[model samples]
Target: MRSGIVAIVGRPNVGKSSLLNALVGQKVSITAPKPQTTRHRIQGVLHGDNAQIVFVDTPGMHRAAKKALNKAMNDAASNSLHYVDLALFVIEAGRWTDEDEAVLERLKSVKSPVALVINKVDKFSDKNDLLPLMEKLAPLREWAFVMPLSALKGANVNVLAKQLMERMPEGPPLYPEGQVVGHDLSFTISEMVREKLMRSLAQELPYALTVETEAVEREGGLLKASAIIWVERDGQKKIVIGEDGAMLKRVGTAARRELEEMTGGKVFLKLWVRVKEGWTDDPKALSRFGYEGG
Candidate 1:
């Protein structure tokens, strides 16, 4: 059977996580509108009749400051390019920026074949314009394949999956046929909570906060899970909690509903917001939050 690792690399919000979910037909990675929503290397597995493809969704490649967490995220993305058998270089259709160029530069040294994936093509008004965009991008690197598709709309995503599956090397499947992801249940559940919290908050809170599942216990048919939401400051914590803790209640409700659907069981979710100053810049704290350096 054809099976191998493929890394999805791109600038933030270019739909890399969405593409992984689309390819695997499941949510292996949590996504938000904000940049750097993905901080770890998430693996999404796609199983076919005769082949299996393991797609690694990396953190978005972006210019980092001297912050330890930022560097770790950048390292995680760059490291993904090295270990994979194939790399999908995702970019927004009809758009190219220095960050995209920066990602391409990192791919230059990798031995794997790079496939240029032009995502979000459903936004394009004129389909004919893609030829010029492809022409403009091809000169920069000799791409193994240039595919334009919309990860959100599922347009041409199946074609992209077929092409990647054909490129897989002949080997045993890295993961079992029924397995669709590499993350643990608790990890994915906490991520779901974080996703809901991130979507509920303002622009600044999402970056300052991170969620961790403290405990998951089975009480008969329901799963009782407790999660802690860490923020950088007490003020941020207050904001997250809102007046009479309404914000937290809403976030928890939304998260619990999604978690129930994902796990196929009733969930009793409890969330607590705490302040931990400078956690993002501290390497030890970042590691505690699963942003360990590559």
Candidate 2:
């Protein structure tokens, strides 16, 4: 059987997470239209009849502010390329920009083979519309493969999967058959809550907010979970709570619904919002939030 790690590297909102979900046929990672939605390296396992592909879904690569947290997130995306069997260099097929070329230039240092997987092909009106995109990428003649796919539509995903297998060496599965993800159960739950909040909240609020699963315990036939919503200012905390505690209640209900689905049991969820001034820039706060390698 063939087995190896495939790093999905690209800019934000390019359907990187959508591609991961499509490959695994499950929601193993959180997705958002917002940039830098992914702050951690989430490993999603794709199991075939004989082969297993471990997909490392990383945060988007971009120039960051001087903040340590931003630097760490950007570094994590690049560091993923250091020791991978193949790099699934994703790009949007509907558009071509200098940033795409810059991304290609930066990845040239990697010794492993690179597969240029052009995503969002469904946006093209016809095959002819894709010609320009292919033309722009013609400089990368040495790429292992230039593939077009629609992660949103699951078009040609199997083709990309087959190519990934060809790029990997024969080996045993990296994870067990039933194991499809690498995020801790608690961490996954927290991220789901964050995704819900991101969907419900306004701009800048989602980025300012951080979700943490504070307590999880088994209670007879149900699971008990408590989460903390960290904000940088008191006003933000009040805003998350809403009038008459309606917003917090909504967040709790949403999180519990997801937790029940994940654990296959009823969940009693509790959510609390706390203010931690400038937590994003605070070193101690960064560590607490799992932003390492700063």
Candidate 3:
């Protein structure tokens, strides 16, 4: 069987997370339109008949300010390039920016062959409209294959998966069949809750928030879970809770419905917000929030 790690690296908001979700044919990673929406290396395992593709979806690489968490995120995205079997360098087909080109340059040091996955093709009227932009990126195109696909619409997604597999090294299966991802049901449930909160909250608010699964109990044909919504400030906590706790209720209810559907068990979602000043800057806090390194 052909199996290996395929790293998806790109700048923020270029549909990197969306592409991973599409490849797995499931909502493995949470997605939002905002930049830096993904802050961790989420692994989505794709098990086919003869192959197992372990897709490592990294956070968007960008220039960061003082915070160690910001630096860690950028470093994590770049470090993901090392030792991968293949690199899927995702980009926005509608527009090409210098920042995108800058990120592509870093991929040069990657040991694996890079494949360009041009996402959001549905935005264009036709392929012809993208030819000019494609021509501009043609120099790097020689080093990789260009795949025009829309992650949201699943257009040409199968084709992209087929091509990506062709580049993977032949080996034993990395993961068992019928397993869609490496993460467990509890971790995924928390991620979904975080995703909904991330999509709904303001940019600054989402950054400060982190979701943790406090408890999971299965009884009487149902699963009940308690989750905590963490924020860095009391005011941010108030906003997340909202007037009469409307916002928290919305996040909890949406998350519970998805849990019940995916897990086939009823859920009791509990949400509480606590203010932890400068959690992102604290090394201990970052590690607790799923970060690997210092």
Candidate with maximal lDDT: 1
- Candidate 2 residues lying further than 4 Å off, grouped into runs, are none
lDDT of each: 0.89, 0.84, 0.83
Give one digit per residue, the lDDT tens place, for model 2 in 1-294. Answer: 989999999876677888999999888888877877888888999888778889999887766556766777777788899889989888898776665666788788988888888899998879788888788786774788899999999999988887787777899999998888888777987898898888778888987878888888888988887889999999999889999999888877887787788778988888889998888877788888887573
Superposed Cα deviation of residue 5, candidate 2 (Å): 0.6
| Worst ten in a row by lDDT for model 1 | 285-294
Q: What is candidate 2's local distance difference test score?
A: 0.84
Backbone clash pairs for candidate 3 read: none
TM-score order of candidates, top first:
1, 3, 2
Residue 272's C-alpha lDDT in candidate 1? 96
The residue-by-residue lDDT of candidate 3 on 17-108, one tens digit each, is: 88898899888888888888887788898877778799999988886637878877887888888878888888999787777877887877
Better of 1 and 2 by TM-score: 1
Ten contiguous residues minimizing lDDT sum, candidate 2: 61-70
State candidate 2's TM-score.
Answer: 0.94
